[model samples]
Target: MTLALLPRYDEPRLLTAQMELIDQSFGIAMLGCSLAAMILASGLAITGGHPGALPWAATMVVACAIAHFGRLAVPDRLTEARSGRYARAMTAMLVLIGSLWGLVAWLYLDIRSPAVVICVLSLIAGMSAAALAVFSACLPVAVGFFVPAIVPVWIVFLATGDIAYLPMFLGTPLYLVVLMIFARNYARVARHAIALRFENLELISQLRDQTARAGQAQRQAEEANRAKSVFLASASHDLRQPLHALGLFVVSLSRTTLDAHQRQLLTHIEASSGAAREMLNTLLDFSKLEAGVVTPRPRPFRLQPLLHKLENEFAPQANARGLVYRTRDTTATLFGDPSLVELILRNLIANAIRYTRAGGVLVACRPRRFHVSVEVWDTGIGIPTAQHRDIFREFHQLGNPERDQRKGLGLGLAIVEGLARTMQTRVTLASTPDRGSVFRLRLPLAWTAPEEAADPQIAMRLDGLRVLVIDDDAAIREAMAGLLAIWNCPCRTAENEDEALALLDDFPPDLILADYRLRGHRTGHEAIAAIRSRVGRRLPAIIITGDTAADRLRNAHADGTALLHKPVVPGELHAAISTLMRESEWSRAEQ
Candidate 1:
C-alpha cells in the first residue's frame, strides 16, 4: 500500500475513545473509594460515633459516580444535562450533610480516634461531588467545579488528621498523578495523528502539481513533433515545385544555342535554383541536427581563402539587394571543423540579407584575449525581443508570415545554432526590430605567421579537370554532367558500380564524385573500393547523397571518403573538386 493510504490513528475518533477511557477509569476508582469510605464510616458508627450524616455522605459518593457514569453513557444531550443537574443537586445535599456530620463528630465523638478521619473523608467526598456540578468531565468547564471542590478539602486536611485519614490524603494525590500521565499520553497521540494528517494533505497537493507539470510537458513535446511533421510536408511540396520547374526550364534552354539575353535568363534561373536549394537544404539540415545526425570533421584550412570565396560569391547578391557585405582583416586563425564554421556564417549572412531591405550586412572578425569573435551585423528589419529566442526553434518564423516569406524555410538560425554547438563555439544575437541585427560567433584563436598565408596567385578554376560522376538518378546525372561541362570539366556519368568500373578501366579520372545510394543494393563505397583495388591507387572521392539521415553519414565515414550532402551547390562542387585534385596530386607525388 502507498504511504498516503496507510492505516493510521484518527484524531477525533481517538480523542472520543480517550475521553471514554478517562470516564470509565474515574468511575470505577470513584466507586471503590466510595465503598471504602462507607465501610470506614460504618466502623465509626459501631464505635457509637454521632454519624447520621456519615451514612448520608457515603451514600452521596456512590450516587454521584453512578449518576456521572449514566450521564456519560446517555449519548443524548438533554438526558445528559438532566443527569448532570441531578448529580449537582445530590452534591449540594451531601455538602450540607457532611458539614453537619463533621461538626457532630467533633462535638460528641473522640477527637483522637478514627471519627475525625471519617469526618475529613466525608468532607472531601462531599466537595468532590460538588466539583461535578459546574462542569462536564469531557469539557474544559470541569476545571472550575473541580478546583472549588478541592479547595475546602485541602483546608480541612490541614486542620485535622487521624489513622483512617492517611488513605484519603495519599490516594487522592496518587489518582491525580495517574490521571496526569494518562492525559499526557493521550494528548501526545492526538498531536501525532493531527501532524500526520497535515503532512498527507501537503503531499497530496504536491502530487497534483507534479502530475499537472508532467502532462503539460508531454503535450508540449507532442505538439512540437506534430508541428515539425507538418512543416516538413508543406516545405517538401512547396520547395520541390519550384525546383522541378526550374530544372525543366534549364533543360529546355540548354537545347538551343542561346544569345546573351537567353544566357542571362538561364543564369537567373540557376540563381533561383540555388536560392530554392539553399532553403530546402536548411530545412533538411535542421531536421538532421534535431535528430542528432550531424557530426564535425575537424581539419586545418586557410581561413583567408574561404573568406575570399564568400566575398566573391555574395558580393553580387549584396550589391543587387543594396546591402554592404564586408569582412575584417585579421591574422588570428581558428582551429575547428571548417565546414561547420562556413555553415554558421552562411546562414547568418543569408538571414541578414533576407531581413535587411536597404542597409548593409557586415562580417567582421576580431581577436579577443584567447579567442576570435566573428560578427555578422546587418541593418534590417531586426528581430523582436520576444522572437530572439524563438527564431532558433525549428520552423519558427517572425513578423508577417506572408511578407517575403518565400525567401527562406525559417531554419537558417536553427542550423546556425546547431553548427555552432557542434563546433564548440558560442553564438550570440542582438537585434532591434526594423533597425538592425548582429550575430557573433566566439571561437578559440589559432597560431598563424606571415609566411603561412595561402598563395595569392593560385587560380580558382576547374578547367580541363577530369571528374567521374556516379549516380542512380539519370536526370540528376545529366544535369550535373551538363553543369560540370559548363565549368570545362571532362566529366563521365555512370549508373552503378559496373558502369563506373568500366569507365575507370578505360580512363582513370583525376577525381571521383559518387552518389551514396546505387542500384542493385550497391553503395558508392563498393564501387570506389573496386576501382581502388583495380588501379592500386587511393582515389579522392566524395559521397554525395540526398539522404540527410544519420546512418548515411556514418556509412560514408566508414568508407573513408569525404562527404557532401545533396542537392549540391555549384560553388561547393567546384571547391570540393579543386581541393581533392590538389590533395590527390600531392599524395601521388609523395608516393
Candidate 2:
C-alpha cells in the first residue's frame, strides 16, 4: 500500500538541473548532425546545377549550429529563466526546429530525389538518436524515445516517392514495441524499489511501537514503586499512632487501679487498634494490587456463604450510612477464587456505602443456565457515563473533587477490576449520574447435587498455627508477632537468615514470612532456604516486604514463592497465615 505511490521525478526544478548537465553533450551531437546534413544537401542541390544552393545550405547549418552552441553555453540561465512552464515550451521548440530543417531540405534542396534525400534523412535521424542517447537531459524519457524514431520517418515521407514511405511505415511498429519493453523494465524496477521501501517503513513503525510500549511500561513500574513507598510510609505512620495508644492503654490498665468506665474505655481503645490494623492491611493489599503482584488461582467455591459473609460485614456500615444493604441469593455454588470474589464485592459495597447519602445498596445473585450473575446495585453518587471507566483506574476519584478526604485510597475499584481481569470475568458497570450504579460479576456456577450438599453455613477458623516472620524493621516484626499472637498463632521474629536460623534450632516454624530485602548477605528467600535445609522439608513461605520493585516481584514469582506487603493489617495477616498453614497441613496429609 505504501508503495502504491511514487515520488515525482519529472518536477520542473530537478528536470531542469538534469537537462543542464547534459546540454553540452547534446549540442555537439546536434552540431555534427546539422553539418553532415548540410554537406549532403550541398551535393544534392549542386547535382541539379544550382549555384546558390550550396552557400544557402552551408549558411543554414552554420547558423543553427551556432544557435545550439549558444543555448549550451547559457544552459543554467535558460533552465532558471523558464523553470516552471519550460518543459512543454522547450519540447515544442525542438519539434519546430527539426520540422523546419526537414521542410527546408525536402522542398527546396532535393524534394523528388529519393537517394539524395535518404542520405540527408539518415543524417538527421542519426543526430536525433545521438542527442537522445548521449544527452538524456533536454527532454523526458518519452521525448528521448520519440525524437529518434519521429525524425527519420518525417524525412523519408517528405521525399515524395512510393518507396520512400516504405522505410517510415515499417520502422513504426518496431519503435512501438521497443518503447513497450523499456516501459515494462522501468515499471518492474520501480515496483521492486517501492516494495522494499514500504517494508523498511513498516519495520520502523513496529520498532517505534515496541519502544513506546517499553517506555510506558517502565514509567508505570516507577510510578507503582513510588506509590508503594508512599503507602508504606503512610501506613506505618497511621498504624503507629493507634498501636502506640493501645500499648499505653494496656500498660496503664496493668499498673493502675481502674474504674469500670476506664476499663471500658480501654476496650474501645483496643477496638480502634483493630480498625487501624484493618486499614493498614487494606493499604498494603491495595499497594500489592497496584504493583501487579497478586496472581489469582481460580477454584470452585460456594457462592452463598461468601455473599452472606459480605452482607454480615457491611450491614451495620450501610445502616450507619442510612443505606439499605441487602442480598438476594441464587443459592448455587459458583466457580471462581472465592477470596478474590469476596474482595471485589467488599470494595463495591464499601464504595457504595461511602458515596450513598441515602437510599439503598443491594447485593443480588441470579442463576443463569450455567452461570450466576452477581450484582451490587447502589443508589449513590453514580459515576457519569464518561467517568465510568476512569473510576476503575488507579488513583482516579470522580464526583468528589477533594478525593484525599475520602474513606479509601482511590484504589479499591482498581483492584477489583484487576482481579476480575485475572479471573477472566467481565465487570460491567451501568449507571445514571447522581441517581444509581450497578456493578455486575458474571461467573460460572459449579454444579453440586442436593445429595452432595453438607451444612451450607460455614465459618473461617484458624487456630494452633505457627508463622515465622523475618523482617529488618523491629517494630513491624514485633507488631506482626503481637497481631498473630492475638489471632492464636505463635510467631517468631528474625532480622535475617542468622536470626531465623538461631530461632529454628529450638522451634521449626510451620510456615515462613520473610522480607524481600534483608540485612547483609541475606534475603527472605535465603532465610526460607536455610529453614528448609535445616528441617529437611519444604516450608510454605510468603515474602513480606515494603519494596514494590517489579524485578523483586518477578524474582519471587520465578522462585515459586508467595508475597505480602508491609504495614499489613491484622485480618489479612490472619488470612495469609491461615491459608499457608492449611496448605502445609494438606501437603503433610498427602505425604
Colliding residue pairs in candidate 1: none
Of the candidates shown, which would achieve the greatest lDDT relative to the real structure? 2
TM-score of each: 0.57, 0.60
Q: Could you tell me which residue pairs clash in candidate 2?
A: 281-569
Candidate 1 regions off by >4 Å? 1-255, 259-268, 284-309, 324-339, 366-372, 384-387, 450-470, 477-513, 518-522, 526-541, 570-591
Local error of candidate 1 at residue 105 (angstroms): 28
Q: What's the TM for model 1?
A: 0.57
RMSD score of candidate 1 (Å): 11.8
lDDT of 1 at 121: 53
The ten-residue window of minimal lDDT in model 2 covers: 2-11
